[model samples]
Structure formats: structure tokens, C-alpha cells
Target: MPKPLFGMAVAFGLLLVILLTAMGSFALFDRLDPPPLDKLSDLSVEVIDRDGALLRAYTNKAGQWRLGIDLDQIDPEFIEILLTYEDKRFSSHGGIDARAILRASWQLLSNGRIISGASTISMQLARLLEPRQKRTFKAKFWQMLRALQLEARMSKREILTAYLTLAPYGGNLEGIRAASLAYFAKEPKELSLGEAALLVALPQSPEARRPDIAPRRALAARNKVLERMATAGIMPQSEVMRATSKPLAAVRHAMPQLAAHASDRLTRENPGALVLETNLDRALQEKMEAVLRDASSKLAADLSVALILADGKSGEILAEVGSPDYLSVARAGWIDMTRRQRSPGSALKPFIYGLAFEEGLIREQTRITDSPVDFGGYQPKNFDMGYQGDVTIRDALLMSLNVPAVALLDAVGPARLMERLKRANVSVTMPEGSDVGLAIGLGGLGITLRDLTQLYTGFVNGGYVKTLRDSPAEASALAQATSNMGAPILDRDAIWHITNILKDAAPPQGAAKMAIAYKTGTSYGYRDAWSVGFDGRYVIGVWVGKADNSAVPGITGRSAAAPILYDAFARSGLTLAPFAKPPLGVQEQDFADLPPTLKQFKLAGLWASPSPVPEEAPRISYPPDGARIELSRTALGRQMPLIVKLQNGRPPFRWLGNGRVFAANGRRRSISWTPDGQGQSTLTVIDAAGRADSVSVFLQMPPSAP
Candidate 1:
């Protein structure tokens, strides 16, 4: 019995010693001295340029921020309102207020659960200072202890300031300043009474308080704060009532969120940078976001969109929308779909034309037959379903005809065109035997908005492809713009001509002036819609489609994406920089004799009809040259012949013209042929010596005119 009692006594003594030691150690370490402001976390700030002005702010990985209000743009009333409702003893307390804590503790104990919060401004600041952790009881105790220590070390004003600067309001928005600007479209200091109250109510529940989500709840919370302020005598009762009666109107403005993303991206791309200077106009940025949001909501198809604005001269990205939502669920822990890959649709046509121009396979006015063509089981058709017999390269591209482009592609060879696109950073891996035709011209390759923007730079910057740079200074410092500095990929003249045609392709709609050149691309099955265009100084590309590549039923680029571009330009106030100047040593020509390929199919009227020979009775006046050519006369019978006058030439020259297969038999040059149609055809005369001339002679029907 005595031993058991002694054992109990020893255990009690050990427990007492341990308790005393822990209490002493905590007392010694818990009262922390205040830290200097300079010792605060390494916070960074981003100042964005917008519409000839600056929008200064900062963001975290979660996209939270502190606006420029604490620098005093925010009203003192807002700060006062928040302190009164959130922490009545903000001025008198350090990091923790004992009275509030006790009251909260009593309420929790009495109710058998916690329904009330008693975090002082200082305690909130302590939470902000530390990394995010679970809200466990132990963590709360640590937080409270730390708050007390912070109070012992810092002044009341310092704690309050830190709390105001670091509090998380919602999304990536932190602190009163950021919340004010993001919601009110004004500085915190510029907030009215009702606006101030609305902001004070958000920290408790950001989404619930978000004007976009719950305006009535937000208004009720604002009124609650106003009533508290009036009861505390901080504001007059009449003033509180007036503010309460006024609607709470703090809508989450979309522009700053987009700017934040752009600013953050620019900063990350160029770290340790003094300033992330960009060409983005803030007003324009806001306008673009607004237009996209409105348009997205109204669109019949359930889809998201991505828009990129760049400086045509410098290749600097002015603005970009990675996702529609400020805090998009799809963007979490995944590649930004805006930066992800999408089928380029017809957005790639200009570059294909650029390749043709470079290869000298087609010229602006080269004539091409706009007829149905089938190559090794491959076929292509026009969008209109009716092909133009003949058109110019400029007309075909402007009108976006498919048959002509396919014809040109076949002539120029797809292998060469693929190589050119690869050089432009476009990945074209269509299998080797696939008939490369106008199908390629209509955007059959996968592409990204960034890649498309870069390719367009050649058009805007005098046929020179330059790497995208982060800043204007770097772009300005690039070597003098030259044509094909790496290799001659495109003819300087061709780029010049193509840019001109695209620039005048269509009239600008809405308030936007037709000061830029652009193209619309629609993918097969209506899966992707794109509009890429450029003013003198900037290039803008927009894409709208589903993440799953599902067809939009009947939407096209011209119908959807073009309107977005027009809206952006009008809202951003973008003006024409200047016309793309032509390069030196580049001459304009009639493009005569250029082959009928995808890029040159528009020029198809140059070949004239061939003279036909009357049956076996027809006579020839000169020695025949060996060659095949289309004759103006059409055969109406099984055997048709016409008179031919061929100049002296060698044998074995194939006369290929007028869509017929013809060859020289001997000195007569006239050969009997079965005709598909009895009309004039394009004629050509060739000799083995490769020097034969011909005349257009009429061929009489063989006693039958069917």
C-alpha cells in the first residue's frame, strides 16, 4: 500500500515538473518582439500599362492581391467600417483582443459548438503571415499565441496595417485594397459608403458576397455593417439608413483579373525585371474581357474562348485570356487551354499561300482551272459547292475558295509546302501520300494561337520571321528587318501582295474601323473558329471552340471569331500603325504563265482555246512537232481533226493543253482525236527541239454536229 502511494506521488511530481518546464519555455518563447516592416515577406508588385495609364497591383500563386488602396487611394471610411464590424478594438489591441476572445469562448461553450468567430485584426494578420495550414484546434491555439506574441512585439497600427494588406477576400484576391478595385472599379479610397460596407462583408464569404453570384446577400451584409457602424456612433443613423437603402453594387470587374494574369505571365517570363512593360491598354483589356464574357454567355454553343493581342512590329504579347473565369476550374493544376493546342482551321491559308509565293509556283494572277479534281483517291471541294471557272490568286484567297487552293497545292507539291510551314514553326505532319491540295489551305493542320500569331509576324514585319520577345526594348534592338534572314522562305513581293489582299478581305463591323487586315478560319465539322488579323502595329488572334473538339453544329470563324476581333479593336481603341511596306528588289508583275496551283488558281483565264482539225479530210501546211496541247476546238465525233501550222522543231514534244492528250504523229502534226466536248480549248504547240509555234485554225465537224 505504501509503495503504491509512493509510486503515485512520483508520477504526480514528474507530471508537475514537465508542466512547469513547458509553461516556462512557452512563456519565454511566446512573447515575440515585433518584426520590422522591412523584414516582411518578400512581396512583389506588378504595375500594368493600360490605355496610356498604369494599374498598380500585386498577386500570389493563388492569384490573390492587394490593391493600391492602402497607399491611400482607398477611402478611410472603408477601413473604418471593416474595423468596426470585424475588430472593434483594432486601435487598442496588438494582435489579439482578450475581450472578444472571451466572449467567443463563452458563446462556444454555452452553445456546445462554435458558431461565432473572435479573430482580432492582429490574429488575422498572424494567419496571413504564415503559410496556409489546416484550421485545427491546435493550429488555432498556435495562431492565437502567435497573435499575442505579435501584439507584444508590434504596435497596434502595424498589426492593423499588415492585416489589411494580407487578408484573403476571395479567389486570388487578398486585402481590402485588391477587393475594392476588383469589385468597385475604383480605388478603395474612392469607395462610397455602400461600397465600403459591401467590401467589409466579403471576407466572411467571398463567393456568397460576390455581386455576380449573390447581390442580395451581399447587400444584406453591407446593411448589417452599416447598422453596426451607426450603432457604434462611427456613422450617423441617417447615413447608415441611406447607405443601406442604396443597392450594393460591387460587381467583380473582369479586366483586372485578366491584367493580373498577363502581368504575372510577363513577370515570370522575365524575372528580376525592373518593370514588365507591355503594349496592353488597360481600358482595352477591360473592354475585351467584358465583350468576351457577354458574348460567351450569349453564344448558343457551350464553349470557351481564348484571345491574344500582340504588337505586330515587336511580337510582344499585349493581352491574353487563358480562361474565361477569373478562377477557372479547368485551369487548376493543368495546362492553360488558352495556351493549349487547337486545330488551326483556315487560319493557316495565308501561310500556305506564302509558301507558294516563296516557291514561285504560283503568282497573284496565275490562271487555274476551278474544276473537280481527284488524285490517287483524294478529292477536295469548295465551300460554296459551285466552282468559279477562272479567278485570280488575290480573288481566290479573298473569297476563300477551296477548289482553287487544292489545284495550286497539287501543282506546287505538298512536300515543299510542308517544309515551308515547318520553318514557320507550324507542325504539319500529314502522311506522305496524302494529296496535298486546297484542303491544306483550308486549315487541316493542328496549331496554337501563339504559333499563328508568330507566323503572321512575317506578313506584318516585311516577310521576316522574328522570335517573340517579352519586352519592347528587346524587339526594338533586333537586327534590321530583313527578308528571310535565316532562309528565303517566301518571296518578299508575295508576302506584300498577300498582306494587301487579306487587309482588304472584308469590311470591319461594329465601331471598329477597317484599319487592319485579317483572315477567318473554320475547321471541318465546325469544330474550331478562328480570326487572326493585324493592324499596322499589332496582330490579334481569337479562337472559340469546345475543349473536347466537338462540332458547333453550324458555326464558322467568320460568323463567330470575326465579331470578337472587331469588338476588341473597337473597345481597345487600336489604330492603324501603317501599311506593311514592300521589300526592296520586289517587283509587281502580271503573274502571266504562272502554274495553276492552290495559291495561283485565281488566274485561270490566260490559256486560250485550241484550233481543231477536221476528220481525216483535214490538211496540215507545215511539218508537225511532237507535243500535246489543249486545242480551242472540241470534238463532236469519234474522230476529230483540224488544220495545224507548226514551226520547225524536233520530235517527241508532247503537246499538252486545253485539257486534252495530243501528240505529233509525223510531219502533219494533226492527229485524229475523240472529243469530250465540241467547244474551243486551250492550245499549245511543242517541238522535240522545244521550239514550236502554232496558229488557231478552225476544225469542221465530221459531217455530224451533235
Candidate 2:
């Protein structure tokens, strides 16, 4: 080199030494403190319906509404505006923009204050991952170093995704998805020009310019973004003007809470799941919820309702409403009534008839006596206290006569009826220290609404009951497992007989008699009223009652729950699927055309003798002599009726309450009597033979009674 060249060589050696030392220091810093990539994995758990509609979402463990996002899930126009306003040369930048940094430094020196920031999207993301409390030169330098490391380990799209996911948007909300959903009530896949502009402005000063907290600041910031887009030629001037004219959202909306109970259960079962996809139909769920709310509103106070709509063949739960109003404290709405067990009343009658048919002990046309009958000491009577002397098995089941059901249950042992239900995976809870008895056919045992609905699936699914499932993936797995290990709950012929009789059942008021087979059940004292029905493709079960197991004065399965079932089928938006055709060897016959053996359900020594025992006097079985009774009141402060029962009572009976005639002539053993007032009273019942039984009791009123 020349003299000038010697000086140039010395300067060049110093420059090269500085560059080598800087590169070595950068590498050492990167290796010692890598970008915290694992922070990106902490995202909000989401629960969605069948069509990918959000049902519910939960915040992260840190109480931040951080949701995962992807580049493709955002509108292209929003992305363009974001990149143009944040970093003009973002696509070509290598973690840090040297030209922008130089311009910022010159502007700071000239102005004596910082006017603009030179932070790229990558640097912003680095700061978000490891947030610094103070904005100093050392913090900025560290963020720049972390940005470089992030660029080396991840692609540009991945970096953008992480930025969008972790970006703050006022309050606890983070990410474009959370902000979009809260402010716009929609996804970011398709945002309006104004909406996109608002979202682009939020992350810069999330707290100060929150649309919900400070609408004017948010609007000014959004207009600034739109004006910049117009100046940069990213958006047309006309579009910018239109977007600026639009107002910002002043409040954040609540997240989707459709199928709250179902979503809550799914999240609890799968705690680690980031997203849960269920088989529920969002539209159907909304419709059913509205129906239940409307119906429950008309009911007595503190009474709630539950409904479930499922595919009978596939067992996919399309809609599940745990209560009419899940937040109502009076209704005990927090409890999931569909999973709670209660008495089924006569709802289990069809299954008992099916068991009898399967054992060749009865036929649909078989004449079964519905008259009063006493099995040892357990006497059963009809619901209305009036019974048809002799009726066909179909009539007995359709009418839900208690005596006939008990007779059939007695014919095909209650244990076997229980076993058949258990074979279909139906769980029944018998009373403590009690064996299966004839009264079980008349709501003697406890069973959940879910299990009862499952048992009814066999009638529609050709005698095979499927396991009900709400989650799509879990349903598929369970379906596969059930297919391999399941057996028919009833034979094909037996199911056909049961379905044929129930299909002719009368519909509730205002419901079109579609080709649906349904059965209604009213538990003892009306504690629980249930109606379960199945069309060609779907099975719907409705439960209406008090969650505390208190009685409703006039609630019945046919009146309270069946109307909801019929309305659900109408609003389901699904075409009524036709019932299955009769299976082979199944035929409809009249009573006289049947063989001698199948003409009637015969049980040796089971029928009561015609002669009455003079030694046994009529006795009041319930509210035993010298007892106290607690009765609930109606919503209007009217007292509910008290049911008085009698045993060993002959043909007609007379009931008197406190010397007042309650009933002049009653044929049944069970009578309903409303006391004159809540106090001590004597109830007297006289049989046809003039034999009398009396019970003295005190009626207690509820706490709120006046």
C-alpha cells in the first residue's frame, strides 16, 4: 500500500477487528439468552359446536384472554394496512431496520425528543414475550438481540403469527382473535375497513385507546391509521373517508356461552385441551334453549326445565339444555338436572311391556286386567283411581295404567326388567335395602333422564341402544367401541310391538301428530315430570320439575314436558324422520285372533281374590296416624294438594278432611285433598262396607308463607 494506502490499511484493520468482535459478542449473547418460544403455547381454551362456531372460551392461567392466531385466519386487507403503517419495508427487513433506526436517531437529535419508534414487528413480539417494565436503551437493545434470535429460529409467517397472538388489546384481551370477538362479535377472517383499522390501532396504546374505556381516543387513533393508509396509497381516499366516518365500538361483548353446561363439562373432562369440537348444533341449541326458557317461565316459581335432543342411531347429542336459566338461584340452576336421577313414574312401562313380549308372555293385543290388584302387601292402582276392567296390552301401555304395568312387571320379574336395562348400559338406583319390586314399573326406583333417554333409543334403533356422546371425536371412538361390545336391549319383534303401540300415542296440545313415538311419566306426588319421544332420526327427552325435589301442584308429564318436546321437534329445523318398518315375524292382530296362550298375561296365584277379607279393615297407608306432613305452595301463594292413600279399601270410598266432604264418591284408593288451612286436621276415609280409617296430621307451610 502507498502512504495514503498505509493509513487506509491501518483504518481497514481496525474496522474489521471491531466487526469480528461485535459478531462474536452477538453470538454469545444469543446463546446465553434465547427467545422464549414456549410462551407462545399458552393460549385460551376454546369450545366449539359441530360447525366450528364458538360455544365458550376460557382465559389462560394468567387471567389473560390470549388466543392463538394464524396469518391465514386474518383478512388480507388488515394485514396489508398493519405492515404498511408499522414497518414499510417489513418483508425485506432482517430483524432490525438500519435505515429507520438512523432516521429515528437523526430526528431525535434534531427535535431534542423521540418522535417515532423504529421497532419492527419482530422486536415488538420479543418485548411481548418478555415484557420489560421500563422502556430504556438497554431494554431496547436486548429486545433487538432477541428479535434476531427469533428471526434465525422461525420463519416470517411464524413470527407474524406469534406477534398477532400475543399482542395486547385492552383489559385482559390479547391477540387479534380475542379483540375481534369481544369488540366486533366476529372472527378476524372478514373485518370491515373501519373494524380492521380499529384493531390495527389498538395494540399500539391498548390501555389509553381502548374502545370500551376511551372511545374518543380509540376513534382518533383508528382515524389516524385510516389517514396513513390513504396517504401511503394502501387504501383509496374514498374508502379511508368512509372508514373514518364509522364509529368505534363503545363496549366489549360477552363471549359465546351456548350449551354452557355441556361446554363446562367438556372443559372439565379435558383440562389440557386448547379447543373442543362437539357434535352439538349451534342453531338447534339456541332454538331449544329459547323454547325451554319460554316454557319454564310459564311454570311455577322455582321450577326449572331440561331438554336433550340426540340422534337416535348415532347417539350424537345435538342439543343439551341443562336448565331454562342457568344463572337463576331460585331454580337451583347450577345443578345439571339431566344427569340427576329421579322417579320415572310410568315412563318405564313400555320397557316392562317389551320384556313381557320378548318372553312370549304377552302380545300387543293380549288382554291384561287393569283392575285393582294387591301383590302381597304392595297394592298398585291406576293414576286416576279409575281403571278399565279389561283392556289390550297396547291400551294399557298407551294409557299408562299403573296396575297393568305392575302386572307385566310381575310376570317378567322386576329383576329381569332391571337386568335388561342394565344390559343396555342404563343405570338404575334402587331404594336402599329394597329388592326390585312390582312398584318399580310405576316409578318405584330412581333413574336419570339421560339413562331413560338412552333406554328409549332401542325402540328407534331396531332394539340396539347407542351410547350418547356430545364430543365428536369421543363419540366416534365410543361408537366404535360400542359397536364391538354392545348387545340389543330387546329383541327386534319385541321392540316393534312397543314402537307400534307408542307411535299411536296422542300428541300434546297444539302439536301436530307426526310419526313420533313418545311416552310421558309423572313421578309420585309430581316431583319430576318427564316426556321422552323419538322420531325416525332423533330422540328428545324433556324434564320439568323443581331441582330440590319439591312437588309442583299441577305439573304432569303430558302437560308440562310433552309440550316442550313437541315444540322442540317443530323448531329443530330437521325434517321429521320416518319410523322404522316392522321387523320380520312381527304382525298386528286383534284380541280374538291371538292364540289361547298369548291371549292374556297369565300369572299363577298373582290375581287378587274376588271375596274381601272381613278381618282386614281399611287403613290409611300414607300420612300414618299421628304424623306430620309438609306441603309446598304454588307461585301465587295457593296451597298444593295432599295425596291421601288407603289400603284394603273396597270398591267405592268416601274421603273427608276436617269434617268437610272432600269426595262424595271415589272408586280409587288414592285421593287428592287440599286442606282448608295449614294446621292440625283429621282425614277420614270410609270403604264401601262402611269400615273407616282416620289419620290426624299437622300441615306445615313453607318458610315464605304469609
Candidate 3:
């Protein structure tokens, strides 16, 4: 009774089975035949140089290798290990492994989700070459089909070679060959079994297998690769055991002959130039690195350092260290601190003095009172808690006096100074106060190594400000907005004068003083130490501080950072040349007779003064022989006939005040003082030689009883 019905049901079931099979085939074919992708190894790297040497490379995009050697020189063991771990049958099979596919499919069906990957070496290469595509089953199938197609088109060895040379290992290292040289500092052909194992483990997870950094994890992965190689009969079992058991050899690191800074420039010029010629002086770079490491050790382990050495005239960065460990392969290590910004201590004073000289607030010979200057509630103390009633701007700069710089900042206008800094590409954030900007004037602002170095260029380059460029081409390409105002901040004569003072004021003995003009900077609480200077040839800057953003106890720029600069110059074997002649308008003065105010106040030997000698008081005015500073009183104090006087070391001196003049001998001079109780004061002076000098000190006194 149901034979016909049973037959119809059977036919229907068979038709359903046929339909399902056709659908499955369509899915498989779709997955295995996806569209081809464009090449993915797109990168542009920057390389920097000094004279004509290869320094280092930095990539603006991915797939850039910064190794100092050729890829072909890499060790063969690394390739073996990579193939053994990433694709065991790389030499025996096509790109797609049927066994692997079956196993993965079974696992996925049982788990109800894709739980494992069956990607062959070719497939992996395809993924790397076209990483922009989606990662779905369809995408994976297409990758497999493409890999198989590639296998048909190319030999197994050819595919493997491409994979080994094109894969990204880690930070800027794009191939196993480059990675081998970078991690071990040796040719790839020279890698040991243990070293090969480590490199092999990296392709699975570059960060995870960073033997130079995470040795324990790298060792474990390397052991696994060795075990696999042994199991596959690629190596003898005894050899595998020995390789797995032996301690990983310490990899030799490349002593990059190029300055790390040069890398930034090279990457911008050529996108795929793996081997770059740089301008770094290898000797100078090594010395700089040594000094930075040593200086940081004196502080906390977390302390960091950054530096840049440039040609003063050419603005070429001879050496640059962005951090203590620029090549650190660790997952967690010291960050590049040089490019980052932090507070600058006394290093910024030169710019202040330069501006003061330009404004005519104080001449090099004018008397500057080194007293405890009170700016509203803010009081600036000296390095030594002392004061000299009288000091010239040149002497103040030589000693790095805080009061005078603050005084000059108040007079020249902090806003103007900030404008100057901004023009130099340094972004400075001012603080709060009637003298808010004064604090920053003494380097209470945050600045980066690049910007700080550029700031000093003004003094070296005829007082004109400019921006920093990775190369001359980049500089020339800058838009008007990016370029600085080329106007002179200080007269060329003024800059020349200040440079001479700085040269004389250099620490009695230091590393860079032999061939450079420099200034040191220390942050509050000694958190950061910086030294920046220039000679006729180059400009250099260095900074040392804590990596964890904590203070480096007692490490001042003069103490810790300047030595690095000195060491670099010494190692580079560069000559220190005399700065060029200053443009005219710089006059000379004799620092002799003491002013009556200094004598009356008994400021000599006072602890609050920037005394010429530790125990002696400072004598001179705003600008010393070659220094410059702005001079103005804090507030409009009672109007008084302020006396201005100048005396040579030899003889007669004359005091000038209120348009009148008086005479004096070599020792000391006194002038009449008349107070009108107003807030303005002016003084004039003429030495026996008839050299005229004038100064105005604004004094704002406490209000009388209301």
C-alpha cells in the first residue's frame, strides 16, 4: 500500500543530499578563490647622517627594517628554525596541507567554532603581504587557494626565501635576516643553535619571543622549536637535546655606527632604503651613550636621558639619543625620553639675557643689584643663598644668577620671550603671578630636546630663530606657518658678545668646553639635567632624568649632563674654534670702582649674592664683557636720583645721575641721591674716557599707611 510513497520519499531525500553537497562545494570554492590583494609592505623611513656615515633609520610607516647590515648576511639557522616552527613541511608540501585542513575542520565542527588555524607558510606570507583584508573562513580559504597557486608558480625554496626575508620581526625590523643581525649583532650565518631557536620563536610572536628582552619566554619557545625540529628529523635527537638544554648565548648587538637621530631623516627620504648612509660620528655617539647611561645610573634606575649634537652653522644633528635604550627589545622598558618634554632649569637664561640686550634695558656694563628679588609673593633664590649688591649682566650669566634673569624677564616682558620660544618651535606654558612669566624665564617651562637645541641656534645664527627639520629638503619644504620669524632677537653684536662671555664662563674643565660654547640646565628638585651649547661648528644638547617621571635626586645639568656633551666632543675629535667676530655696537667696559649703594648696603660677602668668588661679592652691571640682560625694577618704587657709575680697573671713575656727573678715583664712587617718593628712577654714568652708560631701576615699595 505504501511502496510508491516510500520510493517518492527516498527520491526526495536523495535530492536534498545532492543540493547540500552542491552548496558545500560552492562555499569551499568561494573561500579558496578570493581576490588578490595589493602589496602590503608600504613604508617610508628617515635616516640621518653627520659627515658621510650610516647612522640609523626610522620609519614613518610599517615594514621598515633599521638593521645596520645586509639581509643576505643573516644566519641560515634562523631560517631553519622559522620553517621548522611556522611550517614543518615547507620544503615537502604545497602551500595548502590537506591533512592540516582536515584536522582543523574536524576540530571546528566538534567545537562549533573555528578553534585552530591551518595556515601554511605561503598562506602566512599572503596574509602579511595583504594584511588589510578580513580574517574570516572565506578569507582564510582564499588565502589557502592563493598560497597553493603561488606554490605552483614558485618553488618551495623560493616561497620560503621570500617569507623569511619579508616577514616583520619587531619594531622596525621587517625580516628575519635583519632581526638576526639586530638581536645578536652578528651575521645570520653566524647564529648558534640556541640563537636560531630564539629567532625562530619570534615569527610566532615577535613581542613574546624577544630574547634580548624576555629571555625566559624566548628560551621556552626556542626549546619548543628545537623539540619540533628534532621530532621532524630535521636535526639529530642528540643535537636537539643539546641545543634545547644549553643556555641561550648572549647575542651580540650592533654598535650602530650611525647616530640614532640620523635615522629619522633617512626614513623620510627613501621609503625602502634598508641600508642607509649616515652622518653620525661613531666615536661621538658611543661616548654620548656611555655618558647618558652613566649619568642615569647616578640617579634612579627609572631615570631617562636624551640628547642631540648638531653643527652650529649647519644645524646638522651629529648624534641624537632619544632615550637610554633606543634599541631595547623588551616589552616594557625605558621610553624614548629625549623627544619628550620636561622642565628646563637654568639652561634658558641665555635667551633671556639675549633678549634683554636687544631691548637696551641693560648694557653689558650696567650695574645689576643681586638682591633677594621678591616678585609679589614669589621669591627667586640663588644657587647659593647669597647676593651681591652690584653685578654686571655678564657676570650674572657666567654664574647663572636667578635674580638677574628674573629681573630681565620682568623688564623685557615674559609674553615677548614666550613668543620667541614659540617661534623656535618650543611650546612653553607660563605660570600664575604678577611675575608669572619670571618663573619660566628661569627655565620653569617644559621643553623637548629638539626644541631646546633649536632655541640655542638663535645665538649661533645671528640671533634669527628657525624651526628644526629632519633634512635640508624638509626645512625648505616648511610652510610659512611652520617657519619661524627670521627677525633678529638680539643684535648680531649682542649675540657675539654673549657668546664670548659664555665661552669664558664655561666650567673650568668639562668635556665640551674644549671646542664648544654651552649652557647647562637643571630642573626643580634636580628632576632633570640638561646641557646645550654650540661652537662655530655645531650645536649640541643633552638631558638626563628619571624614566618614571620622578626626580633624579641631586643630578644637575652641570654635574650630570654637561659631561656627556664633553665626552661626545672629545670622542668626535672635533676642534673648538673661536666664535666669529660680533657685529659692531658691542662696547667694552672696565669693572673697577664699587657703587655707594653696594657699599652702603654692605652687600659684600653676603650669602645671597652671585659673588665673583664664592666668598667675594659680584661687581658689574647688566651686560658683562660679552653677556646681555634686561634691567628694570619690580614695581615703581619711590622716585629717586639713582646714581650710575663706571670705573676701569686702572683709574679715574665718574658717577652720573639726573643728567649730572661727578668724578672719582679707581677705588669707589659716590653720587647724590634725592627721593621724590614717586615710583620711577633713572641714572646715567660717564667714565673718565667719556663712555656714556645709563640704567633705569623701577622700584615698587610697600604702600604707606592708608
lDDT of each: 0.62, 0.82, 0.61
Score candidate 1 by TM-score against the native. 0.54
Cα shift from native, residue 467, model 2 (Å): 0.5
Residue-by-residue lDDT tens digits, candidate 1, 1-706: 6754555555456445533554455566664534334314434355556342444445544454653223354577777788889888877765556567556655555566886787877767777777456987666666666776777777775676677677666777777766766787666667899888877887778777777678788888888888889899999999888888886664677434445555666666777553456666666666666766655644533466777777766666677665455554432312344566666776767766776677676667665566555544455655533345577777778867776666566656666767666665444444357555545666665667766776777777766655454345445433323313555346678788788778777642323347788998888877888888887677888887776677864456765677777777766777768876777765455664343343333423432233433322222232233323322211111121333443334444456446455654443233333334544444565655556444332333322111
Highest lDDT: which candidate? 2
Please report how far candidate 2 places residue 530 from its true position, in Å: 1.0
| Candidate 3 structure quality by residue, lDDT tens digits, 1-706 | 4755555455456445533553456456546665343332333233434453334434434436633333355566666667666766777766766556655655655566777666789998777766645778567755665676667667776676666656666655766646765787655678888777777767767776676667788889889888888887888999888888888654546534344434653554655664455545556666667655554434334546687776655555556676665554330123556566788889888878888777655556667777765565457876544355577877788878788788777777788887777666556554443344568876676778887887787777787655655455445545224444456556686687678778775642323247467888888876788888777757778877665557644456765676666665665567765677766645544444434432222222312322232222222342123322222111111122222233332224454444565443233333223433344445554444555556655544323211
| Best prediction by TM-score | 2
TM-score ranking, high to low: 2, 1, 3
RMSD of 1: 17.0
